[model samples]
Target: MNLDDLAEKAEEYRARDAGITHEVRVCVAAACQSGGSLPVLEALKAECDSGGTCKVKGVGCMGLCSAGPMVAIAPKGGAIPDSILYREVKPEDAADVLASVGGAPVERLHTPTDQPFFARQQRIVRENSGLIDPESFTGYVAAGGYAGLIKALSEMTPGDVLREMTTSGLRGRGGGGYPTGLKWSTVAKMPADQKYVICNGDEGDPGAFMDRAVLESDPHRVLEGMCIAAYAIGATKGYVYVRAEYPLAVQRMELAIRKAKRSGFLGSKIAETQFSFEVEIRLGAGAFVCGEETALMASIEGLRGQPRPRPPYPAEAGLWGYPTLINNVETFANIAPIITHGGEWFAGIGTAKSKGTKVFALAGSIKNIGLIEVPMGMSLREIIEEIGGGCPGGKAFKAVQTGGPSGGCIPAAHLDIAVDYDSLKTLGTMMGSGGMIVMDETCDMVDVARYFMEFCMSESCGKCIPCRTGTWQMHELLDRITKSKGTHKDLALLEELCDVVQATSLCGLGQSAPNPVLSTLRYFREEYEAKLTAE
Candidate 1:
């Protein structure tokens, strides 16, 4: 088949296949694999081996990695009425799942589609997540993947694209919460011959994998988003700077890019439009500092990946000294939707301030630790108790670590606090790249602060003394506190040092490094005082 014919044939096959075959997609992703998905896969295969024409495919990942060994069954028609999403599947549950092939509906494995985790989520960025095979371009296309790019190129003007984003209330998911439209407008208006769009996949936060999951589960979604972004911002070249640690995510993204290029979805005049866009992959050397925009830009340019001070922001002077629109993976993933469906539709979903759903890598002591996307204005108590299924060991909820080492810890008393940008900041935390780690009573608050302090100290870029030296000093003090060797004077010293670090820090690394310490002290002052009293 020629290129056009092959494309047509692929589309026809996908549609036809969707009708005749029953797709039993099992999660063989990293998180699910660790939770015994292989055995579940074997069991499903064994059932399929004994029987009829059931297509049991091993897909990349479901965002709900914690509720692993997940299973989804797509019936022989045009998508089942909410495809059966089975969590915590075991090998023994295989027969019941397979036996339900004829639409009996497996009662035990069926997860309600109307729950807060699924219901509250407006899956624009993560549309293909947990649904399509991350490696397959055909699968993505089948799920209305490139349609947004098609819509953008065919109908929306560059100005229109920028305007829609501004109206959509889409903010940067890359921690800063900058208006995406304004950022794009800057790059679009910049007086530069060569402009670049960058996808920041260098997700360095300790328990944060929302970006990694999107890259692994829906790489093409990100690619489609980037392509649309390049068109929107008048950029010819783009790059995705992902960290080296996410081997699977990198591999999947690389494969997706190749397929997209081969299918004429990425190259010159994509889908027969005047816009031409191409993207390259730059692998970061696993430097945590690279998560910073300047640092990420520097690393992409083959430098040491350190952050320089900002008057020449990336939009003005970026990679190779050209205008660049750098957005996080999740940020880019939201582009297509803002294009396809009007921005108003998206804006209506979440809170007035924080529009659209936020995806999080929910982990730690929670019973249902996994990746979840919830709308803004949801209470922390609701998330922990209702959506997350509460603490695993039935222990008392202690605190939650939002935003990463650079984030703060929320005590149990503040569980009712609304989880929005302003609210989190008011509580001495920021709605950082959405990593919510639940801690139970077993966790030592002093140790938690010390752990995050150490992470910040180790990951500090050392470009600024406040982050480099201050984080170390704070960590040392925290170490003393946790080890029962701290005095009242040391506690005072830790508080004072956190303030100095916050005041004098450069970039977000130094600035937010004291957040965990500050927030912990605010809520858990008694805990710190208790340690000293015990000593």
Candidate 2:
């Protein structure tokens, strides 16, 4: 299966669908499934089966999660954005939806696609997310899924792939902001006999589901990206470390691995070339610390999931003393597009430093609570107000939290800041896996800081004294402040603890645990001062 063979296969699949005049796509991703999408899907399938030229298929998430179960009706080979979308659909509404397929849309259920939620997004990572059946190998191939891996295997050498990656200027999407090309080049240059590539899918952030959605919606895309990374870094074996809490993502990924193996995409001599790669899924046991690369590698090695100190990073020594290349789900999802288009094509999209779009789980008080992929350097105001539809109800926007528990909250005053790596860091926040949680004016800044501190304290692996003890002390101080039992001395101690924990922690988890507290103090210091009791 070379380039020509892959193209022929894709064309054959497209040809089979040419006979169908109308296609009804139903969202069957986990969120919609929980909203009774399966029954709706079955109802639509039954209605379409008895009717003319209409084909019904179950696809992944359509991004407007609040209005699911969503159904899209379109002509054959039409894009999802051009489809007639129906929201909050039920089994009883299936007939009406099918009847309106070629006619006027059902006005009661129709959702216009011209809204900012749909228009503002740059959907490179999620291009095929809601369009194809996630479990179908042919569906993925038709959507140009493995073209990057095939291209790398056929035309480019290991060094050539590294050069293209470097030219793309893509940084790691796993919140570290490390250069992806630099990491790959380091592993490629190493003279190790055995190397490993690990996709860190252990997204345990409180409001983060970006990685989960990508894996659930397009498992094949991630696999293809891993294949390209392995080929470039000269690794024949890879592992995807996903948290066990995301059962749907794990199930889809497992099925994708089996299908790819059967289709000659995995196992020995992939695409009939000298480069071969094999991948396995490693399930994390709901540990937040495993999101760190060294802790993740430790968990994959059957040890207790805890972060180790870093002078010898994963690229230098990892996975039982073998060099390993670790990237998050969203990072790998970007690989196919960078390879399909030239590296410069991607570099032209985002800011000077952050060179691509970012996928975020827009949660909390926002009106549009779903997944979004926006270009880097887009303003926070645009994301929260335009794409997210602003805060629900009549409440004023107070702050928006980026990067999960590891991130800081941006006050409303700084909403105009560009959302790139350097810009966010200047505001005392890091892009920790693209979790943007909005807060309304009613939220108490002191309580918000306390909440994140509690999460960090509970999630700490207790391996190092700084993270375990420091997070616990900070949570205690925050709780006292929130309850009006704290004095000005406690406030001073809390600020001092933030500095100590940030500088002394062993891994990223502890080091960045004080972000929410520090950022709140920076912008909302009056909130804490107001809560402090007289000594």
Candidate 3:
């Protein structure tokens, strides 16, 4: 399909939708589905079919996961935020919901859109998440889905795309915060005839579902972003490596690929241009290490998922010894927007070094638990108190863990710090895929350190002694301290092990495995000291 054909498709879909007076959207994403959204969806559909100007459809996550099964009703061509939202909806509420679509909203079921949980988010990656039917290709097209790819193909050259990316200052969202434009340029400059682009969807971090939500909610958006990356970097083939645990995400992404291929967006001569790229889905065995780029490529090659030391990184040598460009689900999801709105427009948001927005999954003791995206320079206090609604039951906020098993926990003393790549590093943490688990006053810091250490020890690939044995040793010492069976020597020993593991580890998993222990000790050392037995 050419530019004109794409526009015609979008117009046709919009024209068909214009006839409807009201639309009812049900959150059918995994979170809401588990909360019984499917039955609600079917019930709403039955009511809409019985007779009304109302149409019912299934959408992706609405962000307030605790409030599901959520429903939204909107006027034709209206935005989702302005829609009448209903929380914890039941199947029997369908008739009342449909009846009150353009009339008075069901007061008992109504959820205010003006709440901080919904209003505070700056959605770039999740802009279309709760708005469209994820499985509908025409629905995505009508929402201006692939316009960025078509624009890149018909108007801009490869260098121009690269330049736009550079101007946008987008960083890799899969942690490490590497510049996206630099990585793409490196892959594009490679002298190989065969190049590959891989999207890392193995989101194994605890309390993190940002990637899964993006993949399931706006599968076409990811595909369109991948297509844009392929065109810019001259990649003929690509693979999305998602863990088997995310069945819904994999299913939606697979369906999106098929639809795009049928519409001439994935096969030979995409958009009727010289750019031709094909994408496939590769299921991971739920190995946490495979979230690392090298290990992800190894899994794609049908080998044991493990990380090798990097110098010849994925951008240099990857996937069958050819140049490969690897980016996480969120990084690619930002591509279309950057291309559509120039890179400078994106650079205008966020901080000086870290531009664009970051999507975070809020969990633990927070009252408003769900997915959210905010600008880079947003303070941790703002995220926790304002957006997350602080801790539940008025318990004082104690600390929050960032970056999952490989990250450090920030105590209440540093809550006002800006959450950028550099600021997090200064606090002895890195943004490892944007998972934030808040803690309250009752939590024991020593146990929190042990818990994450246990997770790392279990997930260790055992390829390196530092990660394999070091994590185990750290866990044991923390366990002893928590039980009040360890002396001062044990605390000193734990500190030394953290140093060794951080300095001598083979991969990121081993290296950052000491973060929880170190960060907790740095801020809450009194907890460990109080637990220690007399020498």
TM-scores of the models, in the order given: 0.93, 0.99, 0.98
lDDT of every predicted structure (CA atoms)? 0.83, 0.92, 0.92
- Judge candidate 3 at residue 207 and give its lDDT: 91
lDDT score, residue 74, model 1?
A: 69
Residue-level lDDT of model 3, residues 121-156, one tens digit each, is 898999998889999999999988898999899989
lDDT of 2 by residue, 1-535 (tens): 6678889999999887776898899998989999999999999888776546888998988898888999999887677678899999999999999999789999999998879888889899999888899989999999887999988888888888899999999999989899999999999988899999999999998888888889999999999999999999999899999999999999999999999999888999998888789999999998999999999999999999988888698898999999999998999999989988979999999999999999888999999889988999999999999999999997999999998888999999999998988999999998888999899999998999999999999999999998999999999999999999999999999999999999999999999999999999999999999999999
In candidate 3, stretches whose alpha carbon ends up further than 4 angstroms from where it belongs are: 1-4
Instruction: Assess candidate 1 and give its lDDT.
Output: 0.83
TM-score of 1: 0.93
Supply every candidate's count of residue pairs whose N, Cα or C atoms clash at under 3 angstroms: 0, 0, 0
Better of 1 and 2 by TM-score: 2
How many backbone clashes are present in model 1? 0
Off by over 4 Å in 2: none
Error of 3 at 30 (Å): 0.3
lDDT digits (tens) for residues 458-522 of candidate 1: 88888888889999999898998888889999988888998899998888888888888888888
